[model samples]
Target chain A: MKIAILGTGAVGTTIATKLIELGHQVMIGSRSNTNEKAIEFVNKFEKNASNGTFEEAATFGEIIFNCVKGEFAMTALKSAGKGLENKIIIDISIPTDTSKGAPLSLIPELCNTNSLGEEIQKAFPNTKVVKTLNTMWSTLMVVPTMLKEGDHTNFICGNDEEAKNTVKKLLHEIGWKEGSILDLGDITASRGTESLVLLWLRIWGTTIGTFSFKVVN
Target chain B: MKIAILGTGAVGTTIATKLIELGHQVMIGSRSNTNEKAIEFVNKFEKNASNGTFEEAATFGEIIFNCVKGEFAMTALKSAGKGLENKIIIDISIPTDTSKGAPLSLIPELCNTNSLGEEIQKAFPNTKVVKTLNTMWSTLMVVPTMLKEGDHTNFICGNDEEAKNTVKKLLHEIGWKEGSILDLGDITASRGTESLVLLWLRIWGTTIGTFSFKVVN
Candidate 1:
């Protein structure tokens, strides 16, 4: 599978590396094709890895992972242009407002009533936007088995059923068990997952190591 | 110990019953001293249970549980009057906006930057407010062992350390293991727990039975 990852940050680089290891072609996109970090990422993997501008990467892949920071996700996707049409976008961004400093706060406009996932879905109606992998640490996103032997839960939500199923398959390839994946239904559910970042940060503050939520019956 | 539970809803009655069974004198408060549900709740456990007006209950107990609906919590507390002074309030309410109908939505003003727990704390500056048990179904609050052998988690947050300790002791009496209870810092952390209701409701929409979150490493 050809995968496009938008951003050259920790999350984007981490996911791109894992996808390449799983034998998928991964294109790490950035503001410019010449971005040093994207170039460095491509250099780390000789084959099945490349660097390109956002638009080129989006056009090159069947599935796109919006790993851009939540605050800049919309702008980055807009730059990806019409290439996103009909493609499945696995949105893993949280609209965090860094301006507040310490104790992390989300962007007010996107907090409760609306979310980045819904916004992207609304802006690019032709695209299939599935929101997942935004609730935990970037390292946990690609390797669920690293903690609790992959017993924790992962949530996904989107309007398109087929897109969610495809994303679920990709998640399985990345090491998540089928039982660990929870489909939260429709894009609106992103509000719940995104809001979870608030609790996640607090838990991180108190705990000694990385953790994830397990839904126990 | 004497415990007061404000409101005659499922949560109030449930917690009231548990307190009585645990050998604590329990008072179920309501808008009127003659509320049918409160009266019935008191009658269920004649020795340790009683019913009264909000102010009467508040004055009768050393600790109070604000089990009223989130939208009306502050109003109910205010009606409880000066009797709340210096008392510890175990607040377990979510400010759900039912006006929109179907698919739960929180009151916009309290959804992100603020929460009902903080509001109750602010309204009664002299009282100690500890927020917990608002994230799960009412039955799970007093009998956590009913599911997953009580392995799931419960969260509490408050500005007062002593008050939090008292709440923790009470939680132990209600069947929650000390390891299962997580202290999420000051009252502001209530935002995280309260926001969890969005995800909780969505999960409930999909699952067949009651469930709770267990933070796993």
Candidate 2:
């Protein structure tokens, strides 16, 4: 499968590298055509991996992963332009402050009344926008078995059923079991999952580095 | 220990019962002086349990549990008057709609910007407010060992060390291990924990009723 990962940040690169390892053709997307991180990812991964501008990657893949920062997400998707139309777009960004010395508070403008996922879906009505994997670290996004007992309690939300199934297959490929990936209804549910960033950050500070949430029943 | 529970709702009753069972003198506080639920609790529990209005209960206990609905929390606390001063307030309320047939959306007014815990602290400047157990059901709050594997990963937050310690002891009395209860910085950190109500509610719908979050490291 041809996959496009927008943003050459840790999340994008980590996911791109993982997909490349799984024999998927992966493209690392960035603002600049010659983004150093994207170029470095291509150099490290070699075969089935490449780097390009957000538009080029978006146009190239059947599945597009929006891995950009929430602040820059809309603009990057705008750059991706018409390529996103009718494509399966998986969003994994949270609207939390990532700047130096800034408290990791969710940006009120994006996450308070609305979520980045909702905004993206509104921006590209033609795209099948599915929100998932933003609740955990990028490493955990691709490697669900890393934590103790490997809790597969991941979540997915989208308006389209087919799109959610497609993402679920991808999740299974990355070690998330069928019973583990919970479908959290429509895009509106992103409000809940996205808000999880706050708890995630808090737990990140309190516990050991490698961790994720497991719903104990 | 003398304990006051501010509210006759399920959460308030559940915690009040648990405390009474642990041999503490528990008071069930309500909006009205002759609240039937509180009166019923006193009659049912038989010993170490009483009923009163918010102010009466507040003045009676050394430690107060703010289990009132988030919407009416301030008003209830105001009715509690000066009795909250210097008392350890263990807050388990989330700012979400609780009315019948309500959509159960997190109240954006408090939870979006600040938390009910922080608001209570700010409202009664002399009180030591600790936030905990709002992320799960009232049954789970009192009985943390009910879930599968019984992975106790409860969290608490407050500005005062002594107050947090008091709440921590209460947690241990109710079966939560000392190591399981993490102190998440100061009262400001309540923002993250309070926001968890959204995900909690979503998961509540998707999974079986018996569930709580365990941070798998």
lDDT tens readout by residue for model 2, B87-132: 9888888777655342366566576557788888998888999998
Model 1 C-alpha lDDT per residue in residues A125-146, reported as the tens digit of each score:
9999999999999999998999
* Residue runs of model 2 more than 4 Å from their true location after superposition: A98-102, B97-103
| CA RMSD per model (angstroms) | 1.0, 2.0
DockQ of each: 0.77, 0.66
The list of candidate 1 runs beyond 4 A from truth reads none
Residue A169's C-alpha lDDT in candidate 1?
Answer: 89
Best by TM-score: 1
What is residue B72's positional error in candidate 1, in angstroms? 0.6
| Chain B TM-score, candidates in order | 0.98, 0.94
